[model samples]
Target: MQHEHWWPRPYRFDALLAPGVARARDCAGGIIVVKQGGVPAPLLRLRHPHLAAVVAADCHHHVLAWAGGVPMARLAGRVPVAAAVRWTGQLLAALACLHDAGVVHRDVTAANAMVVGTDAVLIDYGLAAPPGSCAVAGTPASTAPEGWRGHADARSDLFAVGVLLYRLLTGRHPFPGPPFAALQRILHGPVAAPSTQAPQCGSAFDPLLARALAARPSDRFASAAAMAAALDAAQAAFKLHCAANGGLARVAGECRKNGNRNDKYRERERKYRV
Candidate 1:
C-alpha cells in the first residue's frame, strides 16, 4: 500500500520550501512526504505531465515542511542590522502589493514570513480572504485595539507589518504573553516601543515603530506605501550620514598629506633656493 501525503500546490510554486533549494511540482498538486523514523526523511512525490511521479531523494517537503530551512525566530536573532532592515523593508513592500491587489493578508507574522537567502517572502494563505470574506485571522498585536474587526483592511495589513518590523528590531514579540491574554492587551493597550525592550536602539526608532503600531488605524500611516516610504527614508538618512562621515575622513587624510608635503618642500627651499 502506498502512503498518503498531503500537499497543496496552487497556481505557481514560486516559494522556496527551504533555503538554497527549489522544488517543482507540476499542474496537479504534490505529495506531502515524511519519514517513519531516524532523522525523518521526506518522499515528496509529485505528479508531472511528463514523468508520472517525481520522487525526491532525501528531501522533506510535507505540509509541515513549509518550515524546511531555518527557524525564522533564530534567523531573526542571527541577522545583522542591515539585513534586518532589508528584510522588514521587503515585507512592507509585499504588503503594499497585496493591498494594491485588494487582498488582505489577515495573518502576518514572522513565522508566516520566510527568509529566502537575504530576502523575505510572506507565506501562509489559510487566512487570506478576499476584500470582504469576514475571516479574521490576524494576531491581536497586529491589529487595532478597538472597533476594528471583521475581515481586516489594508490598514490591518499595515498593522501586521508594523508588528513584524518591531519583532525584527527588538527580537521579541510586541504583544507577548499567553495568546488570549496578549491579544486582549494589544486590543486595549498601545504597543510598547521596541526601544523599551532593546534599549540599545535608543529613542530614534521609538517614534517610527509607535506610529506604525498605533491603536487607531486612522492615526497610523495612511497606507503600506507611506509606511514603507518612511522606513526607506530613515534607512537612506543613515546611509547618507555614514557617507558624509566617510567623505570627511577622506578629506582629512588628503589635508594631512598635503600639509606634510608643504612642510618638507618649504624646508628644502629654505636650504637650496636661497
Candidate 2:
C-alpha cells in the first residue's frame, strides 16, 4: 500500500467483522497503507466531489481506493484565494453528500484532503463511523465537543469543517497544541475572530466563522450546504468592503491634495499684501 501519508487512514477497515481492530491503529495511530479489496456497499454507491471513491474492500485487512492529488496540508498557504473558494464549495458539497448518504466523516483535516488539479478530495475513511456513534475517532485539533460525550453526528463532522476552514483561510489551526492540549482548547476556549488571528482576513467572515465554531451543535449552521451558502455571502460582502475601502482612500488622498493647494494660496496672498 503506497501512501503519501505514513499514518492511519480515516475510514476504518477490517472492522465490521472485527470492530476494534481499527480503533487501536485508526484512533491515535499513524501511516496506514491504502491497498486493494472489499469496499463497503454504502461507500461504493456514494458519489461526492470531495470524496475519494472506494474501489474495493474486504471485511478486515484491505481497501483499494482512488484518492485525489497532493495532501491539502502541503498546499495550504500556497492556494490562491480564487482556488480556495472553489475548493471550499466542493468540500462543503461533498460533506453534505456524505451526510446525505448516512455517513459521518468524523475526520476532515487537511492531511486527509487531496488537491488533484481543480478538484479537492477528502480521503482516509478508516476512522469514520455511522452517525451517533460515541466512540472517539478524529484528530485532536479537528474533533467536535460532542465527541467527548462519545456521540458524533452530522454536525460533529461540521465542526471539523469549521476547523478546516480556519486552516484554509489562515494557514493556522483555530486551536493549536499537542494532541491532548489541542482537544482541551476546543472544548473550553472561546473561538476568536479569524481576522484577530490573521489580520489579513476579511471581517465579513466573522459572523460565519462564529456560527461554524459555536460550542453547541444546534447553534451552528444546520447543514454543510447552509454553511457553504453563508460563506459565499460573506465572501461577497468582503469584496464589497474592499472596494469601498479603496474608494475611501482615493477620496481622502484627493482631499489632502486640495487642502495643500488652499494652504499655498493663503501663503501667497499674505506675502503679496506684505
User: Highest lDDT among the candidates is held by which one?
Assistant: 2
The best candidate by TM-score is 2
Please, what is the TM-score per model? 0.61, 0.73
lDDT tens digits by residue: candidate 1, 142-249: 655532457467777777777777776566788888878777767766578765665434444566677877777777888877987888776665455446556424
lDDT values, one for every candidate: 0.54, 0.65
Q: For each candidate in turn, give its C-alpha RMSD to the true structure in angstroms.
A: 15.2, 14.6
lDDT at residue 143 of model 1 (Cα atoms)? 59
**Error in Å for residue 204 of model 1:** 2.7
Model 2 has a clash total of 24
In the range 1-274, model 2's lDDT, one tens digit per residue, is 2222222346554433233223222454432345322233477567665687654455443343453367767655344334555677788888888888877878888887777766778776766667888687677778889977878888888788777777765667788878787777788767778776544445777888888877789988889989889989977876676576674244224323433223343332233221
The collision pairs in model 1 are: 145-187
